[model samples]
Every structure is written in C-alpha cells, then in structure tokens.
Target: MAKKRKVDNLLALAVLSTIVERPMHRYEIAQTLCERGKDRDMAIKWGSLYTVVQNMAKAGFLEVVGSERDGARPERVIYRITDAGRVEMADWTRELLTTPEPEHHRFVAGLSILAVLPPAEVIELLGARLDALGRILEVARRELGDLTGTLPRLFLVESEFGLAMLEAEAAWTRSLRDELIEGSFDGLAQWRDWHDRGMRPSEVTASIERGVAEN
Candidate 1:
C-alpha cells in the first residue's frame, strides 16, 4: 500500500496565516509570527520557518512575487499565497479543528507498556510526572491570568485548551496513583501477576483478545 502524504504542519499554517495578512519575505514572516506571539500557539524555529516556506513554494501553495536587497543584507524573495494555498490553508485548518487524528503523546506511550514495570515503580514514575505536570499547569495558569486583561479570550483559546488538558491529565493521574496505593484498581492483580510471572506470548495475546471481547 502507498503511504499517505502529511499536509499538516504547524509552521506551514503559521506561514500561510502570515501570508494571508500580506505578502512578505521569509524574514518578515518570521518577525510577524514572533511579534504576534504565534510561538505560544505553535512550535516555531527560525530554520524550520525557511524550510516550510521553500516546501510551500514547491507545493505551489505560494509563489515568489519579487526580491529586494536592503543595503548589506542578502536579497530576500517575497512570496504570496497562491489560490491553491488559500484553499489548502482553510481546509487544513478546518480539518485540524474538527477531525480526530492519532497523536503519540509520551504519557500514552508510557501507559501502553506500563505492565512491563512493577506496579510500585510505575506508580513512583507516574507520581513524578504528576508533579512536573502540576508545575507546568501552574505556570500556564499564571501566564494566562496575566494576559487576561491585555488580550482577548479569542486569541488565547489554544493556551486555554492546553491548560485544560494538563489539568485533566493531572486529575486522572492522581486517581490512578491513589488506586495503586489502595490496591483497588480493577484488573491490577491480573496485570501484576502476569508481569511477575514473566508473561508468555500466548498469555499476552489472550489478555488482548479478552479485553476486545469485553469491550
């Protein structure tokens, strides 16, 4: 089977969004993103910004409009969004908001192989994670609070979503930790026993089948 092409890029969206405002050179786009605090909403690197612009031009999402040299500076190429780019940007943004895509979060990856570690040790590690997440959540809340009077809520929606997710994860982690400490988590015994006994291939497959059936 052929692999699917990935059209989603945080930087690409940032670039397209910038170009939509007005055609600009690469440096100007980067400057605008920084000035608008787009970095808070998406990961932005100076190098990657140039690469995404090149790729967008190659994909016909953008076309070079003109070039200019300012004194000692190298000539800079200005670009504008193509008709295709506008359509792509709008479609991609809508899909990103409405569609559920598979994202590999580190916490989920650790949870997947959780049975490999002793329950007590897993609890310790997760507790550490909870502490770190708590600190991050506190920082996010403080920053949001400070920005409340300065910026409109519409501009900070993504920040709000991030803080909410962090809060939710912290809550769930606390519940799981308490269950582990109390020895009351469902299926925990079977999980511990399988791990302690050095789980066999058949046992693993059987457990997965049973879980599927139950669901």
Candidate 2:
C-alpha cells in the first residue's frame, strides 16, 4: 500500500531527483527536469511547480539556501534537498520499485465498455490503434537504438521498459483482433447478436447483468 505523502505530487520527486546533484533555483529545476525528460516519465503540471516547491519546504523536505539574481530579473531562491528529503526520495523510490499499483488506463476503460460498439467496428478501431502503435514503436526503437552505445544502460533502461510495455500491449491487442477476425472470441456471438437485433446499449447491459446474476 502507498503511504500518504506531504507533497503527494510526482513533480516533487522529479525536483528532489534533480536537485540531489546540487542546490538549484526553481527555474533551473524546471529546466533540468525538462532537459532530462522527467515530464515523459511522470505527469507534471508546470504551473504547480512553485506551490510544490513551497510545500516541500514547509514539509522540511527542502530548504532555501540562498537567492540568486540574474541581472534585472527577479531573485530566485536556491533550494537544497534536506536530509529528510533524501530519506523520503529514497523511500518513495523503493516503494515504487517493489510495489504493484493499479493504474486505470484509458484503453482499459474503453475495453471495459467495449460492448457499446459492434465487433466489426471494434476490430477496425483496433487495427487503427495497432498501426499507430507500430509507428510509435518504430520511432522509439530508432531513437533508443541511436542512444544505446552512446549512453550507459542505466540511463536508457526507462526507455527500454517503456518499449517493452508498448510491445506487450501491441501483442495483446493483435491477439484479440485476430480472435475477433477469426470468430474465435468467446463472447463474440452474443455481442454480434445484440447489435444484429438492434438492442439498445442499456438493454444489452441489463441483459448482461441478469445473466451474471443468474450465473
């Protein structure tokens, strides 16, 4: 189980990871995070960065060491990760690495209500999705291939993991599409019958509910 955090936003983790190298002002932190592609790894709201940093300080995870002025620009306070922050970062990382969490993905949500669409239409949509996934995998593979020998494996492991997940999803989607196309999907007959009979979605759902209750 995940424990409650003082700064629950993932941007705080990105901030801690970046500033662990050295104390940085907010601008520098945001810049470094962008440069390192932290936004891709986590959902980061740029507008909420200031508040996150302030809350981290209040939580004793960070401390303002000094202020820096760049010419006529406003002063930026440099923040350093406190000992508590380091502990928090390490603990959070450990929890993430070791624990399994349920994430509700958009694709899963659509699949849960898939009976809303006819099987033929669903197959067509899946084909389109597979094509898009193939293109994305191609580009990502090319980029990662270029970076492979140039950078150490440690840095590229995240990209590797991401590619693995995409590949898995693509493979599973392909299997499902093949099953539907071959008329081998277990519930494909009932699904088609509902659409053939021009049954409303709510009626189909109620029928399915009764079937489940009887079962």
Candidate 3:
C-alpha cells in the first residue's frame, strides 16, 4: 500500500528535488523542472504546480524565504526545501524503489472485457496493437542507441527500462496473436462460438458465470 503524505502530488517531489540545490521562485522552479525533463519522468500537471507548491509550504515541506520581482512584473515568492521536506523526499523515493504497487493500464482494461469482441476481431486488434508497438520500439531503440554514447548510463537507464518494457509487451502481444491465428488458445473456440451464434452480451456473461460456478 502507498503511504499517504502531506502533499501527495508528484510535482511536490519534483519541486523538492529542484529547490534542494537552492532557493528559487515558483516560476524558476517550474522552468528548472522543465529543463531537467522531470515532466517526462513523472505525471506532472503544469497547471497544478502553483497549488502543489502552496500546499507543500502550508505543510512545512517547503518554506518561503523571501520574494523577488523582475521589472514591473508581480513579485514571486522564493521557496526552499525544509529539513522535513528532505526527509519526506528521501523516504518517498525509498518507498517507491522498495515497494511494488498495482498500476492500471489501459491495455489491461481492454483485455479484461476482451470476450465482448469476436475472437477474429480481437486477433485483428491485437495484431494492429503489436504493429504499433513494433514501430514505437524501433524509434525508441534508435533514439536510445543515439544517446548511449552521448549521455551517462545513469541518465539513460530510464529510457532503457522503457524500451525493455515495450519489447516485453511486443513479445507477449505477438505470442497471443499467434495463438489466436493458430487456433491454439484454450478458449478460442468458445469465444468464436459466442460471436457466431450472435449471443447477446448479457447472455454470454451469464453463460460465463455459470461455467465458473460449475468449475
């Protein structure tokens, strides 16, 4: 289970990581985060940065040291990470590294209701998805290869991990598609029968439930 924290938004963690170097105003923090590509690494809601920053300050994870103004622009509040913020950041990062949490994927969601689609159509869709994944992997592999010599492995590890995941998905999708095409999948017959008979969705679901109860 994930522990609840004072400021749960990942943007707060990015802010803490950035300002730990030095105090910066909100705009500076956002710019620094963008420059560092934190947005790509995390799910950052740009519009919520200000609210997340304010919430962290209110929770004592960040402290406002002073304010600064540039030209006729409105003053921006400078914020620095507090001791508590450092502790929280370290602990949160450690928790993330040490723990496994369930994450929902759209592909998994589609698979969950997959029986609703005819077996042939499902096979077609899976092939299309695999093709798309192949294209994505091709581009990612080229980019990662280009960056390998330019950047340290430490900096490129995330890209490598992403590529590995794409590869795994592509392999699994290809295997499943092959099973469907070969008529080797265990439930393929029943799946096709349901569609060929034009069984209504509710009737199909009820039949499935009865089968489960019997087993």
Candidate 4:
C-alpha cells in the first residue's frame, strides 16, 4: 500500500479548481497543471498530487466519474468535483483572496529540490519558468490596462501591487538564471536522505491504510 502524506491546502485547492472545470485522470491533471504553468517551482509533485486526489475522493470532495483503458496501459480513473468540492473550492478561494497571505513552505522546498538539478538543466528550467511567468504577467498587465478607469481606485492600487509583485519575481528569476549561466553557484544535493527518513511511522501507516483502502 502506498503511504499517505498530509495534503497541502493550496495543492488541494488547485486540484479541486481544475476538476471543477472538467473531469480528468491523474496524468491529465498533471498535464493540465503543467499547461496552467503553475507547477514550475516544483511546488507540486506527482506523488503529492496523486495523494491529494485520493484523499479528496475519500473526503467526498470529488467523485469517480468513470474509467477507461489508455491504449495498452491499465485502465485510468477519472474524477469530477462533487457539489461539496465546489462549495469547498469557493470557500477556499474566498479565504485566499480576502485573508492575509500565509508564508508558504512549499516555495522553499521547491528551491531546495531545484538545488539538486544539474546546473545547466536548472538554467533551462528557469528559462522555461520565466517564459511562462512572462506570458502570465503580460496577460495580467493587459487586463489591468483595460481596467484603467473601470475599476475603483482601491482596486487599481491593489492590481498595481499585484503586478509589481510579478515584476519583482520575474526580475529575481532573471537574475538567478543569469547567475546559473555564469557559473556563479555550485550545485548541491537537496533533500539528500530526507525523503525516506522524514516520513514519520504514523504517517507511513496512514499512507499504507489509505493505499489499501483505495485498492
């Protein structure tokens, strides 16, 4: 049985949001996440995603829609959001937008993992991430530009702040990419033995139970 891990609320929210749009299988969810360009930081891992989907289904936030074989592979499970999932998504979205932002450890964890990637590959990855971020930033900029006099002054200020944040992130990414290309930093193994050692016995048991339940 696969071991269970605690699911991140943001990851759960992301998966639920995507499922709300349409039903999808695990691989499809991963592909959609890549397409959405939000997984660049390695904040979302396949194991974590699979775990979340299983837990959400168990929690009644999602329902299995159907299953079908993918070519020669085994049958794939597809899922769609339950009504409860939609309500949870809405509630989370509201909380996300209205509440003060919380410090996100996932970002740090991602960077730590990225530290293990080959220097050259890291540069390439960062370039791709920057390109994706650029596209998103452009769209946000255009949308905000169109809202010049349409939105209230307070909203305009908030929008500008959001854009500024994006710009700062882009700039930081560019700086990191340049540093990597220039060979300014040496690569290090991130998460060395932590992956296996970090799992608590209780958590491992929970994961095993979850996996057995699923199977």
Find the candidate with the highest TM-score and give its number.
Answer: 2
RMSD to the true structure for each prediction, in A, is 3.7, 1.3, 1.8, 15.4
Candidate 4 lDDT, 74-110, residue by residue in tens: 8999999999888888877676677675467554667
* Comparison by lDDT, 1 against 3, better one: 3
Model 1 ranges off by over 4 Å = 1-7, 194-215
Poorest 10 consecutive residues of model 1 by lDDT?
A: 1-10
**Roughly what TM-score does model 2 have, to 2 decimal places?**
0.95
Q: Mark the regions of model 4 whose C-alpha exceeds 4 Å error after superposition.
A: 1-8, 104-163, 166-215
TM-score of 3: 0.91
Query: TM-scores across all candidates?
Result: 0.82, 0.95, 0.91, 0.49
Give the residue spans of candidate 2 off by over 4 A. Answer: none
> Which ten residues in a row are the worst by lDDT in model 4?
187-196
Rank ordering of all candidates by lDDT, starting from the highest = 2, 3, 1, 4
Q: Taking the tens digit of each residue's C-alpha lDDT, what string does model 1 give over 29-108?
A: 98898887788777888788888999899989999999999999999999999999998888777777887878778889
Error of 2 at 118 (Å): 0.4
After TM-score superposition, what is the CA distance of residue 8 in candidate 1 from its true location, in Å?
3.8
Query: How many Å off is the CA of 113 in candidate 2?
Result: 0.1
| Structure candidate 4, residue pairs in collision | 3-207, 4-207
- CA lDDT of each prediction against the hidden true structure: 0.85, 0.93, 0.88, 0.74
Clashing residue pairs, backbone N/CA/C < 3 A, model 3: none
TM-score of 4: 0.49
Q: Write the per-residue lDDT of candidate 2 for residues 75-173, one digit (tens) a residue.
A: 999999999999999999998899898998999999998999999999999999999999999988998898899889988898999999999999999
